[model samples]
Target: MPQLDHGANALVGVMAAFGRFELQQELSGLTAVQAWNLLSPFLPLSQTDPMAFTELLCHGVTPAGGFAAYGASRALAELVGLSFDTPAAQAVLDGGIAFLREAGVPPMRVRPYEWDRWLDTGGNVESWLPVRPPPPPERPGITPLRPAETRLVAKLGAEQDSNRVFISRDGTDFVAIVDARYSDEDPTRARWVWHRASTLYLLYLQVGRSLQTPPHWVAAELEAYVPLPAPRF
Candidate 1:
């Protein structure tokens, strides 16, 4: 495996390092190798041609690429073990993070294999990118989500016996779920908030957590959930 230039092997190695269950069965009985050993062939490439290295793991133009980038980058970062003691490892980790930001956020879409609908789109962005996406510029009149707005903000899951929805668009945008009973008349179902570890919630983080000019309609709707301001006396 000396000429492992394509990086799928490195990605797979990272996946195994992270204990991906599927890889477990396939990799068993093999002499255990360190994640670094798997990534060794790519280290020089990462230092000299980081973007090319990124392209090896990232399928930039594909639908699933958005969903995969952060997880892949984070896995690489963790496998490398980010610490000052390991500057070489840190540089490699930094390169991966740089590649993610350079690639930018993909246009909003549902995760591959998901139903083609907006609610499902929330799961597309996957995870918080390794670096902080620059914050959206502050607008003079911009305000945060309010109770009224939270009520209108779309819930994460569809209507079912017990489904979770995002009831608020405040703070970092990963609002905690509130438990309440669901009713036919009330669209809010038991305030059942399911935390999707990956998805457009990452999109929120990508845009620096601003609702103004959201990246997608669901986000726009969440932002628009606010009521018109009362006339100031």
Candidate 2:
């Protein structure tokens, strides 16, 4: 197992990797209000005023464009394997409907049969279920997998590579990398880190891993270790 200091260093290195990949850019620009507007339509009608959601959806004032935005956002979420009928989405839709009704805008006119057919054609239904398998168990006491585990190899050429192994603070067992992203220099490494972190977080929650607090160091390492997705304008 690597020493705690080494683990900490590795964590720092991974966070640097995330910076290099521009992970922060993905989150930096949007204001809270914009985010609310984008997400509000998806909220449940029962818990919120449907009119508000509908208005948000319809207020942009373009028919095909509005529907396209909604469709694209929903499709992307589905592709990323999120649920379609989530309370959040429902609420947003309800608000949009109400807004349109009040404005006397014609109903967006997606026939149920036609909508289903469109969804089928777009292959959007595949990601309707949000459940995913847990990541492989961290090697015995190695603690959880860090973002570095996904990127170090690709950054340094395999021949120049150094392996990072660690023992869990519990002082039992150890985790050694089986594989990871190519290296710090590889652009894809950052994204790999993000995906790896997301997967690990999900797995941790699914398996009920206990932590005294948020693992900031681990998060930093992940952001550094993997490439991030591009920002959405």
Candidate 3:
């Protein structure tokens, strides 16, 4: 059994929290804090107790819940040099996403209007209306690819191309859902969509390791990276 480091332990707690919050949000469409009374029992002795943490996860987190949890876990691991690209890490992430999809949590999307309001109001925005401004057109040599985007493209074995990038009108952020072949004619090439929630998960892990509070802009940037489904409500 591998020992849990400070960073890993903190990451487990973050994942657990994210799992709980995502479940609550999905079931009620509301974001609420986990009640202290409800969460105290499963608290780990330290940040690196993967066993205790995994046990708690087994008891409370489902597959859909795992999506948020595992995503956060992987991000934390990556930041702390914990080998996120390992087979174990991949299993955790794949299992979590599968679980969420099976549980009927809709595919995630980016909603910029809500994000803007969240930033303006210090995360007190209440509306879910689709209201974000269109992302600035992808400039020829100006836009920078986020770390996550770069990592994901590399994972997909695709070369980076500026023309391949597109921005969501709702969230006004860059997206890397481009052809794996980097060709205009082959529409069937692989494309991966990166979301704000996923990026937020990464940021949360970063913050947890530093034990530092992130400014609202960090959250706002993450929110811009969130991917959303078509409007249904």
Candidate 4:
């Protein structure tokens, strides 16, 4: 795995690799101290550094050239969840939850998805532009929201015109939905998909399982994930 010092873009690549490989075993010795060193190298002091950790989280995922702070925070939360049995790790989790509860406004919510929205010739509204791509698939077993209210959070890829990230958060928990685009004219080309392939998604899923409160529908699906059966000869 790339060191967090390398930057968030590198971390995002690492998250995607996890989905393609069953390498949870690789993380076997990944203790909270190690995870802290890997993710928040900004604080070289220790794992229990809530003041520094919270400040970084509040910085809105601006690790060099990254925009997904939620993803990074979720990744840390996953590590915290896996090792909550340890007193030190538990302290980190406690500090994080407390930070969330006490924060007047999280940086995650305050940052703009696009720093250059003024230059966006297309504008931002989903409907005002053109075709209404079918909504992303309802999570496997979760009841589909008839008209789920979602807001665009980030746009991924080089073109800055595709792979949209949308989210619906209800204060305590949030579900991120990906609306992947390929062609503008072909409605069939558009697909709504889970963000599972991304490290951010996987981290959130792992941490969600460990949260005391009910996990979001998307995160819950990770627990139920099963590989396809092999072809029988």
Candidate 5:
């Protein structure tokens, strides 16, 4: 049996960011598109699935999470030149993110995925805009809206966008959803942020925001993650 409590959190964290809900899929049971469609409601956008997300997380027919965790540990151990991954266990201290810790592991730092030193400067929205903003609303209009109406609507026009993040027009962007425990809700209350992101962004958060792996990271899956078949473990 695979111990989800041991090393599965990292895989869950990564896939969940991309709104991948079918984390339990097995390579032997489901096709890529089947798993993708199974997770359809969890995604915030009807737009095409992220180009590399499913690929990076899923190598073959399904996600095969159990195997993925084994792979994560294998990758981490190889990277650190160790037989096990405890030495590279991640932690969080002071409000900032911490990668591998040399001391007793502390709690994980859960920040908005986009948190950075720039936030330490106490910058406002205007400070980080890639483009200029329009002047204050000339009239009372809450026409603008978030990409999803799943959450409660406090305002109609300008007041509506608060529940979501906005990206520039004609530019590429990614939304990483996190802290979403509401997998079964009609409209999940998972926290999501739309930020300018890249591959570096993923690595940056992956390293900095980790802490001790939970004794057991819950398996959110539709496929049986059986480990009895793998040759290495």
Candidate 6:
């Protein structure tokens, strides 16, 4: 799509290439009306000049454009593949919702259906969006995925390098989960760890078996390390 010339509106395609921080900074402190001011000229509402039409379409935003600024801000998310919320972009949106929530936007008198859709098809998008996931199970030695402060600092092998691993924050608290499976599955997943980046240079001085991240080859080297189970009683 061609770029428009209306301030940020002209940079619609540019938004696609921008990282989360750039996008967040692009829309940090704008009110709902002000934000859409950049969007309106390209909207159907603006029939006179429909230049940057694709901008409105990129984020799965429909013709409705309900929550205006919030909707447009959300439309800044990464919509390429799997469509997970990018950290920086999500931060700005969550801040706006937090402000409204503190203002007591939803009174207790309001029923669930008043906010949620009737059919329960996972589309209960109210003024706030990206329905929050339920809390994870509580367990010791593993920090709960809450507080929004959790960050992956180090992914260390669990005791014995087993199916489980310790994903820690700043080398301190950690949560145990199935290994790189935290990123992807076994057969379908293609993993390339940083074995050749930092410590790998020291641990493996020469280019040989020791200088590699394991499980890359199926039969070339895997057959040499298979351990049979102990005889059962």
Instruction: Give TM-scores for every candidate, taking all chains together and pairing residue i with residue i.
Output: 0.30, 0.21, 0.26, 0.21, 0.17, 0.20
What is model 2's C-alpha RMSD? Answer: 20.3
Residue 222, candidate 3: alpha-carbon lDDT: 32
lDDT (0-100) at residue 120 of candidate 1?
31
Per-candidate clash tally: 5, 42, 18, 1, 6, 1
Please give the range of 10 consecutive residues that has the lowest summed lDDT in model 5: 221-230
Candidate 4 at 180: error in angstroms?
Answer: 29
lDDT of 3: 0.37
CA lDDT scores, all candidates in order = 0.37, 0.31, 0.37, 0.36, 0.28, 0.30
Model 1, span 144-181: residue lDDT tens: 44544643333333334333334444444445344445
Q: How many residue pairs clash in model 3?
A: 18
lDDT of 1 at 138: 46
Backbone clashes, candidate 6: 1
**Error at 126, model 2, angstroms:** 13
Work out candidate 5's RMSD over C-alphas. 20.6
lDDT of 4 by residue, 45-136 (tens): 22555444434433423232222332334444543333334443334333333323233222222223221221233433331223212222
Q: After superposing candidate 4, which stretches have Cα over 4 Å from the reference?
A: 1-46, 60-67, 79-233
Ranking by lDDT: 1, 3, 4, 2, 6, 5
Q: Total backbone clashes of model 1?
A: 5
Worst 10 residues of 4 by lDDT: 224-233
Error of 2 at 90 (Å): 11
Per-residue lDDT tens digits of candidate 3, residues 36-107? 322343344325554444433333332334444543443333333343344444445444544444443332
Candidates 3 and 5 compared by TM-score, better number: 3
Error (Å) of candidate 2 at residue 88 is 16
**Candidate number with greatest TM-score:** 1
Question: Which stretch of 10 consecutive residues in model 2 shows the poorest summed lDDT?
Answer: 189-198
The TM-score of candidate 2 is 0.21
Q: Report the Cα lDDT for candidate 6.
A: 0.30
Task: Give the TM-score (vs. native) of candidate 4.
Answer: 0.21
